[model samples]
Target chain A: MANIHDVAKAAGVSISTVSYALSGKRSIGEETRRRIADAVRELGYRPNAGARMLASTRTNIFAVTAPLHSGTYEPAHMAFVLAVTRAARAYDYDVLLLTEDEATKGLRRVAASRLVDGVIVLDVSKDDERTKLLRELDIPAVVIGIPDDTEELVCVDLDFRAAAEQSVRRLADLGHRRIGLLGHPEQIYARGSNFPHRFRAGFLDAASALGVDAAFAMPGHGPVGVRAALDELFEKQPDMTGLVLNCEEPIQASVLDILADRGVRVPEDLSVISACSSFDTTRFHPPLDVIPLVAAETCVRAVELVVEQIAGAEGPHVELVPPHYSEHGSTAPVPDLRDAR
Target chain B: MANIHDVAKAAGVSISTVSYALSGKRSIGEETRRRIADAVRELGYRPNAGARMLASTRTNIFAVTAPLHSGTYEPAHMAFVLAVTRAARAYDYDVLLLTEDEATKGLRRVAASRLVDGVIVLDVSKDDERTKLLRELDIPAVVIGIPDDTEELVCVDLDFRAAAEQSVRRLADLGHRRIGLLGHPEQIYARGSNFPHRFRAGFLDAASALGVDAAFAMPGHGPVGVRAALDELFEKQPDMTGLVLNCEEPIQASVLDILADRGVRVPEDLSVISACSSFDTTRFHPPLDVIPLVAAETCVRAVELVVEQIAGAEGPHVELVPPHYSEHGSTAPVPDLRDAR
Candidate 1:
């Protein structure tokens, strides 16, 4: 909202001098130009002068780039991006969501065109190609997921590693000797999606530390995929009395139903824990005990982080939100399973 | 991509003459001014000349204004909006999603600032206040749902009335003499959300014409509401053999679970049909017999309509797409109650 007059007054220069320096229609002293530039940055002046388009290019809009129009429709991704929109508004900024076509192109266009001052990218892949472009750009950016190399980047995510470990520890503490984990789809891990790989590693580590058995399967998207994965896991750990679900697909219902149909009463014959966003709900079954992903909080933090970086906050920062698990209904003590054992 | 030079050549005027007509920085002949304006409109020249910022401000951005950060998270609304984002891109536009705070303020800010060429408002209420301001805006706009009044508004939505009527007619054709509809939450109807009211009216009309029995409930948000509504409906119509679900809360799975729990068999003891978005899916239960709401298609059409209007096409248009039902295994002929009767 600052104007040329305000910039001039703040920089202790005449109105025409500020205009001339910005316009380059005339040359001004380097020291004076530096003073004017600092004043403009301080005031966040969106210059209306014709030639100072560069000085006025900060649109106060942050682009939210996500794989929204991709083949898979993940509701949680939508949730995270929308939450980012809300969070950005608190900083008095608007959000331009880039969801269609090669997201990398969208990223480049917005930044190159000066359509946004900063950006927040969601569902980032480990070998994410966008980070390289973002790293090279002058615009500030933050990611909702960590990538393979965090050097010279700002990243924030629900600590999936801690979430997975907590989920396992919760079940193990409940006296469950054997458990199965329905992980992300195989491709997610193959693509080196940070969350799945981190979760799997954490689950394995926790299982080892707790001296309990853990069987893992990457669940498919649909019913058959979910059933086959569940069957495969159970086959490997037939005496499994605890389960951890780390996926957010519709398989939530399928898993509960399959277990029920297989005569496994939740938390009685089996206890199920979900490592997903607390907003997730399965319709037919008792709600799973959720180790919270805290999507909205994480989104808010990411926006603040990016905006801070944009406003000259220093350093390559990484924020990992600690786990806060919510127990709704899905967990209970392992039932007397000596007969099954 | 056209420039002032293109307009100058097309209008048979000097580049400065066209600039004068656009910038009002100098006087030009009346005939030449008219020619320049025509050429500008024809070319969609986003003028960079400073003073013409007001005269020729077309940012080629479409604002997607919805209550995304509000209380309840409706995935259908999210789906419709993300579809609009995808649809806008095909027309060479980007989406600026306004989700935080009063949506009217958001709408006002975007148009007043010339930040967007047009807007798409989703989850439009029956007596929406945004339409009035939009009518006053120079920028073109469209709504995803038709409000109480259609005069001078370009509106499009799934024909909920026809959808309701179709659901009933489909069941009637299958010999369903008695049916119940689980309508939206009582507050949604109370708040005058057009869809629920329209659906109920259509259902009543269709049932009357076919001389079939119909029961309705404005249920609550979750499983308990579903159960109470079903219990109340069946308590009145004890032999109710068909159901129409016209709600989108977490009750989809609950309904099926309750039916199965109560020893009622789908399509055997009862038939069920849904009047909701085609994107609506419950992971655990058998898919419903759904008359698709066509959210993505509706959203696509809405964007095209708004962008067309922005492209100088005038309209007070209304497009109501008829229902296209999908049989996903949750409906069938009514039970043979002849023996019981």
Candidate 2:
């Protein structure tokens, strides 16, 4: 309702003086500051964000583009988004969350319009269309997930391969000769979901190197689907003594049920580990022993990188955060199956 | 990047004509359209979103604000946000997501900066600070959850009281006299969470009218906490026949464990029903009878109302969606406790 000019006139000061007083960028006399404050209160003047952006050439806003599925806002993803937001705020910036479909047109529009200083793209595909567009537009952008080509882009990624290899090695050390891997649905990988494919590759490669028998299956949501998938995996590979689950949502009760039905005990007969996010671990029934969701930290780092790049810092940079595992007593020495058989 | 002026010059047309051609807002001769397309492709011209917004005064964006917990997205809330996005897209608008902390400043920025035409606020509190600010601003706003003062606001809310009453009636029909209500934490209600408080009020009122003995408790997350909460409830009122769960996630596994531990049979010894979102129902093992997460539909309706109001439509409007229950074999006539004892 009140403009900067009105505040300036009411405070008996210049517009620049009023601006400095509000932003606290420059020092003003105590009496002048009091007068400006009184004027602002009297006029109910809220500083216009657009005018501020126009003056300082800084919107103090970061944009994020991701898919808008029901599972997209999972606890882990939310944590990552929040971490980015909190990190951005620390530097006096806000986050603008844009969905994938909207990113194609809407984000392009917002970026070109100068609504935000930089953007962090999530759920990035192997050859992300958004990455190409961002490069084409010369808009400073950071990608959360790794893309196929990283030559000229700022990107942050988790060492999924290392995490998977470590998990398999842990199982191998526990004497598990036969292991089963429960992956996300085929559609996720077939559609080029990066994390699942990377984890799967690392898992199988490590299993082969260790000379251990391994089986894989894609499980869907809910216990029924998980139960069916587990039953199929067990029926096909009845000798499997350990499981590595890469599914997003945990199948806590169903996994327990399948183990019970097969007359198996956790750690003793069948050790279980998953590539779970920290949020998932917190809510997991029998807290999983696996890598914490590094995506959040990656997001924060990506935002910082993007901001630097936007401010004309340097060339493309990449950050790879190593996975940290949470040991929760779900893994142990595999039991002797020959005696039971 | 080639600007619109370059494309316009190459196409031998005014910038307005090129704009219209690109937006498909007006009919142009086939030859003219072809020339514009060729010019755009040849020059790699992309429309600038900022300049376009300033010129056209229609950014075609809607904003959404909601709570995002680390371990829980709350299925119902997710559905609502998605529904609003999908619905907005159908009407040719993109949805922008804002978190709870960002609501005050971020929303104000988006509105005053003309980044979005209108906003749909979810998880509305009794005296929402955001609502108060929105009222002061001259932007169109819609609230998904009911506010304390709804005189001038457009709102879409579920009849929580009626839903609770209906649930009680269903339990009563099954001949349950003593019912246990497992509600969300008091902190949730105390923080002005609308649905839980309304549901509790309805449950208490209906139980009182039905002359049924009822008790309420809020369970913590995970099996251990849930079991302890259930044990406490049972200890306080051992004769409880029907259990109504208000908090969705924690109780899913705990209910099964509690029943198994107490040697109680579902439907026969106890009946369970919950006001849970559809996503929660799908993920839940041994699904409970529930009122579907109608948040998405509410979101859609709220957005529509806000857009209409922003477009200069008259009068305050409200849409109250009724609770629809699903019978998933979780409820039945209460068992004869005396005979079993």
Candidate 3:
């Protein structure tokens, strides 16, 4: 409730002196600064947000436009949001959350008003309208997913293509000639979601390059849909020795359950790898080998780049965070029929 | 990036006239208002957040303090957050998200600086420290979850106790003499989360009143844990003909899967009910009866109450949205065991 004048009077200093001590824009004596600090604590005087923004040209807030559409996997979305929040907090910044309802309008309002110094775009689609708006706004922004257009936009995301390639390579090196890919729901791919398309392409391209037999299936959700997907995958590649799951957690868990139901042994019968998964693979029945989708790695980097841009550091560029793979004995060498005989 | 001065010059009006037109603090001629609006659009002028705040004494923002602790179920948490965001938008307010790391500190900072018009608290624990800090700050705040101490706080939440009691009564009316409850992870109860404890107690009390045998178990996660919980429940009440699931989606799915695997048919053998579940229960194996935890119901009401408080209307109070039950053929009359024999 106390204003600058109250703080000044209590500290026995001018309003300008109090502002300087708090802002650190100008040097003040230690005794005077301590007195100001004591007065501020005693009176619970908080500098007005408007006054601070006018003086410093920074509100120390970032607008995080995370649109949760119909196809969003909540766990992954929540993870990324929390990661960005924590990363922003490390720089003494707070996040203004913008949901799907007012995606672009929210960004525009916050940026135009100088309420936030920069923006962090999340849940980006291939032809995202927000990306175009961000480009036009020319505000300090970092897109967490690769959009169709990259010109004059700073972007950061997991190298999904590389992750897919690595998952195939890991299985290929294990002497698995036949592999099956379980992708996201069909709508996710049809909706022009950027990452799933890239991951699928990478999987097919890597399979082709390695001369490995690969079949792809998109599971809907739950046990029934997952079972049908597995049946379709087996029908296409009956000799499939390895499987790569590139879908949400529930579907992946269902796939594992279905496999267990069918008496299929992991690693021994079918080597499995969880690609670009945000959830913990170790929790799976047989802890899986996973190219984990690390939210913090990309989100932290994105926040840092946006902060750098806010400080007027450099031009826009795309930064791809490389994926890290961990094995939990879910993958193994393909079995030889002759040896078994 | 044009300032008010630029807008006024372009509109051919005094700066004071432009301010009055934008803020609606004073009446201006229609022609002058239209001219200022055109100037604002043409020059891409945005009202300064600081100036607007100082003038109106409002930030037009809500501080949403949602702490995602270890026990948090992501889907439920995300649902509440999104619901609040949409609801706040209805009243022309944006959400400033504050996470677990700076739980109380974030609330204090936002409230003290008057950066947010009000606060929306989520994922409340029994002994939540934020409630105390909120009381001290004396800011207009509405807590979405009920904490242990409700004095001097505006709280909105689902009536978990009533939902639990209603679930038991629904089964009891159908001649289910023995009932079992599958609750959340043990840590959720051990950590003093408000709802689960209330729900559990209500279930026990209701069962006792109806003279129906009752058993309760807390499942960790996955098929194995769910199976163990079911086994524990059955061990306690072997003739359990009705079941109430108050756990996460995966655990509930696991229960259905395990029951199916063991040749236990829904409604015929076990009349299952999902209590306070956020996810669609129809997606389960055999669509179970459910008391849905409608996020929008509580969150929208909470936002409205906070906005009212911000407008200096009424005192702090608690509001509980009554639970709605939906049947999906998961409940039926208990089988006549003697007649069957």
Highest TM-score: which candidate? 3
- The per-candidate TM-score of the B chain, in the order shown, comes to 0.81, 0.87, 0.95
TM-score of chain A of 2: 0.87
For this target, which candidate reaches the highest lDDT against the unseen true structure? 3
**Every model's DockQ:** 0.24, 0.26, 0.76
lDDT of 3 at A322: 93
Candidate 1 collision pairs: A267-A270
lDDT of each prediction vs. the true structure?
0.79, 0.75, 0.90
Q: After TM-score superposition, what is the CA distance of residue B289 in candidate 2 from its true location, in Å?
A: 4.3
What's each prediction's TM-score? 0.78, 0.81, 0.96
lDDT of 1 by residue, A1-341 (tens): 56789999999999899889876889999999999999988986655422233346456788988865444445677778778887898887888888756478888777765667788988788888788888876679998889988888889998988998899889888888899889877877876667888888889999999999999998876768999999899899988989998876456767887887788888778888888654565444777788767778899999889888877985787889999888777888777644456
Q: What TM-score does the predicted chain A of each candidate obtain versus native chain A?
A: 0.81, 0.87, 0.96
True contacts kept of each: 0.38, 0.18, 0.76
lDDT of 3 by residue, A135-190 (tens): 77878999999998988999999999999999999989988889999999998988
lDDT of 2 by residue, B209-258 (tens): 99888888877655666777787778778988898887766465567666
Candidate 1 local lDDT, B272-299, one digit each (tens): 8878644555443666788877667888
Instruction: Report, for candidate 3, the interface RMSD.
Output: 1.1
TM-score, candidate number 1:
0.78
Where's the lowest-lDDT run of ten residues in candidate 2 chain A?
Answer: A276-285
Worst 10 residues of 1 chain B by lDDT: B46-55
